[model samples]
Target: MESLIKKLSKSHKDCPECPSPKVVHSFFESILGLLFPDFATELLKEEDQISEKIEELRHKLSRILIRNKHLHDGDGAEIAHLFFLKLENVYDLLIQDVQAMYDGDPAAKSLTEIIRCYPGFYAVAAYRIAHLLHSLGVNLIPRMITEYAHSKTGVDIHPAAKIGERFCIDHGTGVVIGETTEIGNCVKIYQGVTLGALSIEKADADKKRHPTIEDYVVIYAGATILGGDTIIGHHSIIGGNVWLTKSVPAKSKIYYQAKMYNPASDETDTYIIKSEG
Candidate 1:
């Protein structure tokens, strides 16, 4: 017990001070609350109150960066200032995302409902915010924010992934977007979809390991598109339960067909891809 205690003490002493999980979650929630009326704890009555809240958020981010100062470059205050300067652009991108979700899904009743209740919106919002921080070279906290969304929404998106404008995720559970994944605009991905790497090799860590999804592509549920070289062309439809690792041309339709099995030839599998080209 004494040896274990001493080991734990040494580990604690060696670790650098970073923002706590609660602080990271609070920071994310605060940003959401500030941006949309649906998530706000209480509406700011005046313009001055809104400005003060924004400043408070900036201060919180600065303090978070300051705590893990060694993990990044430049002054924390300067980084925080730069982040705020670019925040409007982020808000604009999220607005586009919200529009995409509302336009794509028939079940969505209104814009406010998407903002308030959709897990896909929550997950993508976390990604956009974390992606901004990642761009500014703030390391650990960005990951924390994305992970918080992942834990709650079951929509796992890496902060470093490049997602284009008007992207949508429907029935978002079990969606995985990898670190190096690149997604284009007007793309809709359904539940149980994986944009992942073919290999988990450490040597490929620096390389683009995930697939590239072109614009206007709709990848339905249970579709697995893997490999860095794999690219799904624009305006294509990738159907459910389809597994793809090779590149397909534009306007392609990839799906499986359940054929009647041969009773005499010892073939048991009934499902086959009628055309995966």
Candidate 2:
């Protein structure tokens, strides 16, 4: 007991205290509620009340950043101010994402439903918020925020991944978007999709390790695209269970052909590619 206590004491002293999970979650929920009323408990009756709420959230963020100043380079208060200034653009992008999800999914009856119930919206919302903090040079908190969403939604999107506007993730369970993955506009990915890397070498950590999906690409459920150099061109349809590690040109359709499902069969399947006329 003495040895264990002595060992933990030094490491505990060395490690700086970070913002508590409750505090971080509160900040996220407060900001989200302010943006979308579907998530808010009560609506602000006046413009002044709304303005006060914004300032309060800003102060909350300032405190969070100030608490973990060791993770990033800059003043926490200044970063908080700048983050709010550019937050309107993020809100606009989120609106576009919600619209895209509604238009893409036939089952979706209204925008309110998607905003209130969809796991994709929750995951994407976390990602966008984290991405903005990441851009402001804040590090650990962004990751913490995304991981919280991942825990709830089963969608693992890294804080650093570059995702374009109007992105839609339908039935988003078991979806993994890696750190270096780059996705373009109007791209839709279904459940069990893994946009991953071929290698896990620590030496290649600084290099690009994930594939790029171009505009208007639809990646269906259970598709796995890997390797840094692999690029799926615009207007491509990647079928369910299709795995690709090489670049495909624009307007291509890729799918795997299997005669029948056999749990007992240990057979290898090949994917067929078709280019649009």
Candidate 3:
């Protein structure tokens, strides 16, 4: 009986195909070494000269930040150190995403595929890097990183946004998540989805400036959810190409339809309201 139990409890050891876990750490170190060469070299002895080039770029950036007053009450050396530390956290978050993508999606057959082919991964990676700079008060650099991701993936996620675990962004293109947006765990968002602010010109910077999405919500492609006060209830489904600004009830469905109108005749034709709920 004991032998049978042991056999039952034994785990299968499969072939390791992807290096998603290690890649993020190594890439983070590489990016950091490229960003602050002297510091990276000093910290990591017997390093490549790539660290030196990083230091050169950092020196130029420090001067620019000082000139532009982007940093407050911190010296160039201190800012650089803080930025690196923040980036380290961001790198950890990115690794979490890599793990999530690897474990959750069957299509992610390998770590290499995830790193090279997944736009969602790239967008999240850029956001992680940018968020570090944002927290470090390196205003311009964070935006630049996020913007680069946006340009490449068509996914514009601001660095200041707070996102929870098991979040999946599918087909990532044309997805925009604003700075103040708060996303909960196990949320899935598709391409062309926008969690944006209704009042881009509003004066409420401290107040909520974007939508709050709860857990287990699925936002379909081309769905635009706007407003600071908008709250998407848990387990809700937002249909594709729908425009929404108001709060949605839990376990609800939403959609949109258009009808042709003639100004001269003052008549409407083929009015349609498409919805499952």
For candidate 3, give the lDDT. 0.72
**Top of the candidates by lDDT:** 1
Sort by lDDT, top down from the best: 1, 2, 3
Off by over 4 Å in 2: 259-277
- Candidate 3: clashing pairs of residues: 37-51, 37-54, 37-55
Task: Tell me how candidate 2 scores on lDDT.
Answer: 0.91
Model 2 lDDT tens row, 1-277: 9999999998787776777788788788887898898888789879999999999999989988887889789999999999999899889999999999999999999999999989999999999998999999998888888899999999999999999999999989999999999999999999999999999999999999999999999999999999999999999999998889999999888887756545688655544554452
| TM-scores for every predicted model | 0.95, 0.93, 0.69
Cα lDDT, model 2, residue 277: 26
TM-score winner, 1 or 3: 1
lDDT on C-alpha atoms for all candidate structures: 0.92, 0.91, 0.72
> Against the true structure, whose TM-score is highest?
1
